[model samples]
Target: MSHHFDYPSDETLDISDAYCFAGAGDAHGPRTVFGMNTSPFGAPTWNATGYYELKIDTDGDYIEDITYRATFPIGSDGTQHVQVEQLTGAAARDRTATGMIITPPNAPIGQVVECQGGITLFAGERLDPFYNFIPYPVATTTALKDGTFPDFPAAGPASDSFANTGVRSLVLEVPVKITGREPVHFWATTAYFDKGHNTWIQVQRAGKPNMTTFFDFANGTAKIADYNGTAPTIDLVGRPAHPATDPATGIWGQVRDNIAAVVEAGGTYDQLPHAFPTPRAYGAWAADRLLPNVVKFIPGTVALWDPWCDIQNGKGIIEDIASNIIKMIVNQDFSSGLTPGPVLDYFPYLSTPPPPAS
Candidate 1:
């Protein structure tokens, strides 16, 4: 019901990514769409400050230098208005500066805003970068269970969980100077700006919302390090009663730090950039009955025949196509990162073809 981060194990979460440099709306552009998420519990869209940022490491050791922040605030009409700012000099060093909305857009949403300094932040819908299995969350267990997490395979089909349903996302397109804060081998994380007095607190980083994901203390342990003990440490589900505490994690603060470290150390992708493979990766990872139908569907979607979404078939149809062909791309010569693929370029967004033999 409330906002929360998507999970790595959930069948419906959109946690995939690619590399990129600059950002844009034509998304016919943008170097890459590294990650995305639209949790499947399905909530109507509401207002939330969304942003994408990068931590620059002008200094040594790959730790974040000054962090760049982008906040997306929507106007009453629902068009995305944006603000961009850097937390450097006295700003980042001072905790007090963190709460200041440094770059408020002037002239409102007239396609331009003098966002602090001279950075002009633009807001609008671009082709969602993250991809995953769709319609498969509701699919049969056996249907989606393949390359997905070992214990859960059926979570294969990935979809842009956000769609139009109101997943107000925060995307930050940092210039290479800033993102280089980490090594090419550094880390990436996504979070919402805490508007509450305790706003600096990244809630998604603190404790994910319940009913949104199957990830927990143990889920992190198995995939990465033994951060949590042997049993699954489900968080925030009942809360207050069960309260989202992790005894293995000593204090709530430690849990967040522990999770970030685990993934960071392992060089593994977490939460967003749903990079992990699942049964939904391939079109056929659906239930047996639907299995025959994926091959029957993708090849046939061009013929005006669509896959079914009901119990018997049509399970991972949307998810598979989006990932395999829709999201794939090759990096530019500069390694600016992933760009739209030639195949996606050739195909009509409906049913198109790969570029002619390159």
Candidate 2:
């Protein structure tokens, strides 16, 4: 991750952009929360500071209507003090008006650990809510032993592996009204000011805000949001696929089933690349149906989706599970708008051209 930003439409996605937030499972992992420590991911850049904002435009006209900010402790241990604000237009640009600490009323016990100056801080371990390689001897592997992929999710129930992680998680959740919709396909990135260098570096935490890194799948590939950072380009494992033209008619079922096959091979990996990213369709499918769109009648709402962290609001899982269900129903017909449930929606663009090293 570098301090520079990638502009897809000669455009960049950041807290300054419309509709965004930052999220991670188990904010108190030793390097990461349990089950997510597989990689020392989301490490802050040099002179990392703890101030971030969630910017969003409920309607994609490109005008940011909401701004939510989180301020973290300025030293090591990521103190996790946070703040939220409700602002409009130029008012938000002013640190004074736009920045106000509000209590996260009724929020879970650890949801907002503290609130100072409109910043409600919640920094602690929540379960590794994002569904990763769990629920099977191999990810994507189904109990349907006949060789055909299972008609539905193979996992008997959602389970927390409790994988130990060393990194402390940092994030905040803004209301849907702030995001402009109850649900939307949003993206996230982090910036840290290296006081020593008197500069700030950037990191695009892969997918949408509050979403687990593993949920950005679409057609066996994911669309990583461009970032403003100074870290090396991260690696994405598994096969990559081209973007799809329409959600109702794509080649995703084959992708999921195929991925299931890959996971089944060597039931428990004894070699390299055992764990891989989930197919991209999972994220895109959910995004498409839940986020507002001109394609179908019901905009900004999915008919069915029951996935959440129960702690910090696992927005990504809500989208991914809907996508997986639709995949099973389609039986490999990526295109058939008759979704069993809403599927994930993919990002309009993926990975940004990384900035130069410090």
Candidate 3:
């Protein structure tokens, strides 16, 4: 399963956060599950009252065909309530459309609220499921500058940096009938109602795990808003054409060069297809695979992230995605060497949150 964990403290306004896509079959039939985690400890709670949305594209076009959105409002007792809606066609693309409400208004957290048409909703705080070496971002940034991949194991012992942290989570399960039986593209976003503008303003969008973290490190947080506000279709084909020598022309070029630089520094540039003998060529190819970032899920199939080719086919919550991404970039069979935490086997598969901190 692909997930995003935004780390920039100053850019908290653009933190749209984690995503997981999985499909399973049961006696009732096949179902698709979408998971999100946001508001890391001490961060702004923009997503709490804002919107957490899942957009699905049934055909290959990268445009959304369906949207499942959830909103949380805090009760007087300081507890959060979740309300979900389903939108399709034009409404799916229109952020202002109310569409159709699927779950009852203000459903309590930590309890599964069943809605019509076999949809299940759960929203509450949960232990963060993403794992990685604590200093991964720093190490990657240094690697880009010094022309060498950092020895991750040398920085520290294997451990989950996200341990002991919690995030507000929204989990939604819908039957395949609503999402369609064919393979679909998936991406998630977070938006806040901008009363100043009289409309909801999208602050963040994500698909693949760590795309912004790993690839955008060199540019700092300068592009966070542009990256978050735009759609995948823009990343796929909307970039301005530029000469090969200038790799900083568009977001696509920036991301492509970022991937290429990391791989080249890791000493794997030569291993890419010999047809593209230069780093820019290999980077261009690699960027193409990653752009228009969205998870592709075929209903009733195993949801596994292909570490070898970076081919995403949905993501399970327990997958060691950090290691998988490292392996994909370096073209080496390496891992973060960190052990992952456990998750539940039933609905709301994320691990339970630790008892309230003392």
lDDT of each: 0.28, 0.30, 0.69
- Worst 10-residue lDDT window for candidate 2 reads 30-39
Error of 3 at 246 (Å): 9.0
Expressed as tens digits, the lDDT of each residue in 1-358 for candidate 2 is 0111222221121221122222221233111000011012223321124334444434444233444544433335444333344566765433345444464533332343444322334333322223322333233233212233443344444433322322223334332223333333223335445579766444333222222222222443434342123111111122234322222312223333343443344232122222223333333333333222111111223222322211112223223332333233222322111212221232111112123335
User: What are the RMSDs of all candidates, in order?
Assistant: 15.9, 14.9, 3.4
Off by over 4 Å in 2: 1-48, 74-80, 84-98, 101-121, 134-186, 194-200, 205-358
Superposed by TM-score, candidate 1 places the C-alpha of residue 219 at a distance from the truth, in angstroms, of: 8.0
Give per-residue CA lDDT, model 1, range 247-278, as digits (tens): 32322222333332323333333223333232
Candidate 3 residue lDDT tens string, 125-179: 7888777765664566566445567677667766677887777777888787777
